[model samples]
Target chain A: EAGVAQSPRYKIIEKRQSVAFWCNPISGHATLYWYQQILGQGPKLLIQFQNNGVVDDSQLPKDRFSAERLKGVDSTLKIQPAKLEDSAVYLCASRRTSGSSYNEQFFGPGTRLTVL
Target chain B: GQQVMQIPQYQHVQEGEDFTTYCNSSTTLSNIQWYKQRPGGHPVFLIQLVKSGEVKKQKRLTFQFGEAKKNSSLHITATQTTDVGTYFCAGARGWGKLQFGAGTQVVVTP
Candidate 1:
């Protein structure tokens, strides 16, 4: 089975510029998640989608970050007017899961965004 | 707000030496998870502990959950060169959110 797929493995952008990251989840997986990982830190959850509806996005900075998963398959996270602090790896993961039980998450090679 | 902490932010161990990282939570957690990230790779889940005082093992790696579910540990027996990476312990306060620790970076020398 193919793992989660993310595009543009690396991106460099200037602060205040807009950038977008995309993710294609593993086939048959019902849950997808996006995380931001900064240097010397762990990946922080940005958003989660169960099917097409968002399950959680409390950590997403609504002022600058927005994400969508149309038709419940692929997802895209965008940061407008990106800041220096937004420089980090954007990771996307998927899992074969149900509303109840724990499932193992499979991650894609993240898109490393560098804000200058 | 919830937080997770890990001790010995970085550890350097010679091959065949044992290494352990501790994870503590500010509040009791519903579940705890462990992940390993290669130098430039995304985190991959290693194990999850849901029950207090539960212990699980995967090969040389051992995971233990504290009796109060507020702490956990990962001990790797006889570390190898392949063990070079960062280990993170994340605690879930609820179903949808997780607070992760700063992670313990491990470097193994031959």
Candidate 2:
């Protein structure tokens, strides 16, 4: 079986420009998550989707960051007018369970973004 | 909330030596998980602990969840070069969200 798939291994964009990252979780995984990992720091969860509905996204910066998991299989994260602080690896992960009772997450290779 | 704290921000161990990392949370977690992230790579899940005072092992690695469910530890016996990477502990509560620790960077010297 294939693992999680992410598009565009790496990306470089100028500040204030827009960019998008895509992710496809492992087959049969009902819970999906998006996190941002800055250099020297642990990943911070940005949003989470259970099927096609959002389970959590309180940490997401609505002013500039937005994500959608349409049809419950794949998701996309967009950052418009990207800031220098937005330069980090965007990781996609999925788990077998939809509740907080579990914590086994399978992560993708991640999309590394560099804002110039 | 800065829920998780990992001790020994960085650790350097000689080959065949033992190593350990500690993780503490501000509140009792529903569960705790451990992950290993190599340099320039994303995190990979290693193990998850749910029950209080739980202990699990995988080969030379051992993991323990505190009785209070607010702390955990990962111990590697006779470390090898393959053990090099950053080790993280994540705490989860009533939601699916995960709060990750700063992580312990382990460097195994040959």
Candidate 3:
């Protein structure tokens, strides 16, 4: 069984540029999450998807950040006109749903983005 | 807004010493989870506590959820080099969303 997969382990861009990160959760997992982890800080949940429908995205910056988990398996997070504050690691995670609850999430290696 | 806070942003201990990190939440949490992230690595789940006043142990690690369900603690006995990492506590309110603490970075001196 493979773990969560994320594309382009690292990326570099300048301010106002655009960048996208991709993630593939573990198979059979029904819940996927995208989190941002800044240096010296814990991960902050940006968006969550249950199957193909979004469950939560209140913390996501709608003006610049957007994410979609189409087909309920792979997800893409896009940052248009990236800012310097966007320099961080973007992590993707997935969890199995049981009855009405979700289990612990397994995370991907994450894409380290550096905005110059 | 729900906020989770961890005490002692950083910790340094000798190899044979014990270490502990405390987490507190502004609001009652439905559950609390612990994760460990090594330097330059992603977070890995260590354990989760769902019941009030719950205490769970794994090998040399012990996790406790407060009776009030708003606080938790992680203790490591006789710490070793392998225990080096940032320990984070996440509090979940209902489902899907998790509020994470800033984390406590542990450094063990050989």
Best by DockQ: 3
Cα lDDT tens digits, model 3, B34-100, are 9999998999999989999999999999999999999999999999999999999999988757889
Superposed by TM-score, candidate 1 places the C-alpha of residue B58 at a distance from the truth, in angstroms, of 1.4
Q: For candidate 2, list the clashing residue pairs, or say none.
A: none
True contacts kept of each: 0.83, 0.93, 0.93
**Model 2 TM-score relative to the real fold:** 0.96
The models' CA-based lDDT, in order, is: 0.91, 0.93, 0.94
lDDT of 1 by residue, B1-110 (tens): 78899998999999999988999999999999898999988888898899999999999999999999999999999999999999999898765466889999999999
* Full candidate order by DockQ, most accurate first: 3, 2, 1
- Provide backbone clash counts, one per model: 0, 0, 0
Deviation (Å) of B88 in candidate 2: 0.6
lDDT string for model 3 (A1-116, tens) is 89999999999999999999999999999999999999999999999999999999999999999999889999999999899999999999999987443658899999999999
Worst 10 residues of 2 chain A by lDDT: A95-104
lDDT of each residue in B21-106, candidate 2, tens digit only: 99999999998999999998889999989999999999999999999999999999999999999999999885567899989999
Model 3 chain B scores worst on lDDT over the 10 consecutive residues at B91-100
Name the better of 1 and 2 by TM-score: 2
